[model samples]
Target: AQSVAQPEDQVNVAEGNPLTVKCTYSVSGNPYLFWYVQYPNRGLQFLLKYITGDNLVKGSYGFEAEFNKSQTSFHLKKPSALVSDSALYFCAVRDVVGYSTLTFGKGTMLLVSP
Candidate 1:
């Protein structure tokens, strides 16, 4: 089984300040990690993914995540945040080896203040 957790229900940041949204996962086998963002009345948008090769993965809208294998964590980050960046962020995971279904976290709301 594969599962993900977004420990923070909400994250608050000021515009132009750095931001982070934490996520952790568990899987029976090697994991394929992903991050997605959903805006108000919109669908999920792919932020980034970690299949293999790199520990640091970059994504759309200046977002990035670090894959920590030992800790089983993938925390999303941005050097500077924007008011438009305020949205619901999700962490997802799937087992790399089998017919594992993708699982997502409840979601973390990112609120950026100007």
Candidate 2:
């Protein structure tokens, strides 16, 4: 079984300030991590993924995530946040092997103020 957790319910950031959204995971085996963003009345949009190789995975819209095996964490980061970047962020995980299903976190709301 695999699961993901987003500790913060909401993340508030200024228009140009750097932002981070924390995520942690637990799985029986190796994990495939992913991040998605959702806008109001819109579907989830793919942000980035961390499967293998680099620990730092870059994604769309200047967003990136750092995969830390030792810490079992995959935190999302952006150098400069925009007001348009405000949305619901989700973290998901699935086992690399076997019949594991993708599990998503409760989601963290990012509020960027102009």
Candidate 3:
């Protein structure tokens, strides 16, 4: 299978604190990376993606991910998180597909408390 891993099962942060969700991956060809955030009872919302260009990819909701080709890592980062930012975050890689099928990790729950 296409290789991908999220090391953290969950992350907790106080309100207005910075937060990060770690991710690592591997693929045969050039990789396309994506990050998604999921709220309860809602579908995965596309946060961002690393398509064919720059290493630092910015996304919605003040989120950004840095794609490291050498390390095979794409870590999600946000400065000064809010309580509303708490959700399940997923890091994905584009596996063999025409529609960019995302191979997701088990997910890391971000608990932001005030």
Q: How badly does each model clash, as a count of residue pairs? A: 0, 0, 0
Model 2 Cα shift for residue 90 (angstroms):
0.2
- Each prediction's TM-score against the native? 0.98, 0.98, 0.92
Give lDDT: candidate 3, residue 51: 83
lDDT of 3 by residue, 1-114 (tens): 576799999999998888999999978777888899999999999999998778999999999999998999999999889999999999989854455567888899999999
How do the residues 1-114 of candidate 1 rate in per-residue lDDT, one tens digit apiece?
788999999999999999999999999889999999999999999999999998999999899999999999999999999999999999999999868778999999999999
Question: Residues 41-60, candidate 2, lDDT per residue (tens digit)?
Answer: 99999999999999999999
**Who is ahead in TM-score, 1 or 3?**
1
Q: Where in model 2 is the C-alpha error above 4 Å? A: none
Q: Which pairs of residues collide in candidate 2?
A: none
State the TM-score for model 3.
0.92
**Candidate 1 deviation (Cα RMSD):** 0.6
Which pairs of residues clash in candidate 3, taking residues 3 or more apart in a chain or in different chains? none
